[model samples]
Target: MNGPAQLADLLGMASVQRAGVALLVGSVGLPVIGVVIVGLDIIPVRFAMMHVALLGAAIGMLTGLDPALCGLVACAVAGAGISPLARTPESLSGAMGLLMSLAIAAALLVLSIAGVNASAAFSLLWGSILAVRVQDVLVLAALAVVVPALFWWRRRDLALLLHDRELALVSGVPVRRLTLVLLVLVAVAVAGGIRLTGALLVDALTLLPALAARRLGHSLTAIICWAIGIGITVNLIGFLVALALDLPPGPVLVLAAGAAALAAHLIPERRNTSWHASVH
Candidate 1:
């Protein structure tokens, strides 16, 4: 069959395929939020979430439960734990490192106890979008709405916090509250996103678009908008391409996003020479 014909067949092949594609579209929203937060220097938080997700999956496997649901709970708890540490300059990176080490070690231990092979454990980290359950889709769809809504409603506050937390505090914004809230939201969104790109490649979906968008956009709002557009486009096109090529979706999607980010450099950066001259 031709490309379009093949894609149509994939979509219509089975209920599971249609469900997976639907989930893919919904889950892309998580990466949309990820790009915005990652651009604000919260990349470590996302990484930590991935570790927690792995641990969650291990626990689920050991207990014969749903790994994805367990992962969602683990993500939330880790977010709460990491929030305070994120505020302390001396502890931020250290705490994340500690959590990452512990989480990975615990995951391995649990997998061993459960008699699950290393490859199976590792598969959780890579994920299989085609294997997502209906419940996973529902969770992702809710996060898709909630995460972007929170960011959109508090765009200015988040921008201020990202620009300078101290300044935001001095300006009477609730820095700690907002920071914690954002972290929690990030955790949830990332947990949902792991279903699509897996823990390892989530950044490819999130950061690459933000990085590329920042190169082309003059403002934070513009960057976020462009990132969302880029993210959706990359996921959709990547999914179709993967279907056509009979390849894995996660890596293909990431590579596509990376290519777009690379292409972004071709757009010449705007220099504020006049403003600098005036200031000088």
Candidate 2:
């Protein structure tokens, strides 16, 4: 058939509908968390949580439990456990590096010992958007709403915290508790993203949009708004394009996000170069 007819038929599938819902929620939510991550300079935590999620998925597969639940739990625990080290960027990086190594090593061991099928393990690595379920959509939807609401409610405090930890503490921002809470939230968000897009490409939904938004926006609220807008645009375009081309949505989405981010970065530089030449 025709391209539009083929896409319509694909969209008619329940699995595709569920995947679309999950993607929609992710496109809206992950970027908000990304702002906090980037502001806190906790980028490494995302990589560490991804590995932890993989390990959790491995154990879940070995024991016949829900991999997503296991991964979320693992991430929460890791988040709380590592929160104490978040006082400094250097310490956070070191701790996250150690956690990433341990998590990957343990995941490999579990997969090897259980002799899990390569496809099963690969699913954890790359995700299967078409296989997303109703429960997954509900979980993602709830997180999408709750995370943004929390960020909005705490916007002022978070702004202070992002500005300076010492100033936030002096301003009674509950730095320790806030840091712990944010880390756990970040962990849960990462786990959710991984369930939909996999570890390798979760950043497409989370970081890239926020990074692009950062380049375009001068304030936290502006950054978040820009990120959400970019996220929705890229995700919808990528999902539809993938459907049209019979390609995997996850990688296509990543490429779309990357292209947007690259454009966001380069366009301003080009403008600045042109202005400089005009001035000279």
Candidate 3:
């Protein structure tokens, strides 16, 4: 087959592959949003969650539980634990650092005791997008729907919290509750992305698009929409390219996102008179 034909054939893959691609698209959307507004705090949390995921996978292997589910639950629990600590800058850094270290050490210990292969224990570092199951797709679809809807419905409040939590609380915005909700959603998004892009590359789906969008958008809402668009575009392109080239999807997807970010950075910034007004 020629290049176009080969690409078409790749796109016209089996039902499972199609579902996996769809799952990737759905799984990536919300985390990119988190990356956009939640700021640098999310970076450490992402790292912590990855370590927690490894521990969860090791434990799952030992217990004969589904590793993916176990990893998701563990990440969610870590998010819950980190949420309160994340309220302040000092505590946030300390918490994520502590958790990341502890989780990785525990995971290594568990893997050793369980006699799990090191490569298998670290499988989440590479991911297997083409192997996603129908059940995983269903979960991704629900998350795709629910997360965006929640963000949309609570856009104003979320905006307030993102802008300044102290101000939001003073304005009676239930800061702690909202922060917890956001953290939980982040956990879910990170865990799902890990399954498709792996723990190491989840930022391709979450962070790069947000960074690219930051270059183009004058306001948070605009950035969010652009981030979601960029994320979905990069995901589809990356998946297709990986399929055609018979390469690892995780790294390919990350590189694609990086390319987009670089391209965005190359565009000269234009001053918008209305930016401040709109953002406020």
Candidate with the greatest lDDT versus the true structure: 2
Ranking by TM-score: 2, 3, 1
lDDT of 3 by residue, 59-125 (tens): 9998999887888888888878777876675676688899999999999999999998978878865
Model 3 CA RMSD to the hidden true structure, in angstroms: 2.8
Assess the local accuracy of residue 61 in candidate 1 as a C-alpha lDDT between 0 and 100.
86
lDDT of 2 by residue, 99-185 (tens): 999998998899998898746765765677787778778777877898778768877777778667777788888888888888888
Q: What overall lDDT goes with each candidate model?
A: 0.72, 0.82, 0.73
Instruction: For candidate 1, give the lDDT.
Output: 0.72
Model 3 misplaced stretches (Cα beyond 4 Å): 36-40, 270-280
Predict model 2's lDDT versus the native. 0.82
Tell me the TM-score of model 1.
0.86
Tell how far residue 5 is off in model 1, in angstroms. 3.4
Q: TM-score of every model? A: 0.86, 0.89, 0.87
1 or 2: which has the higher TM-score? 2
| Candidate 3 weakest ten by summed lDDT | 271-280
Best by TM-score: 2
Candidate 1 structure quality by residue, lDDT tens digits, 15-79: 54755655455535665666546544667767777888888988888898887788888988887
Runs with alpha carbons beyond 4 Å of true place in candidate 1: 1-4, 15-28, 88-90, 112-118, 271-280
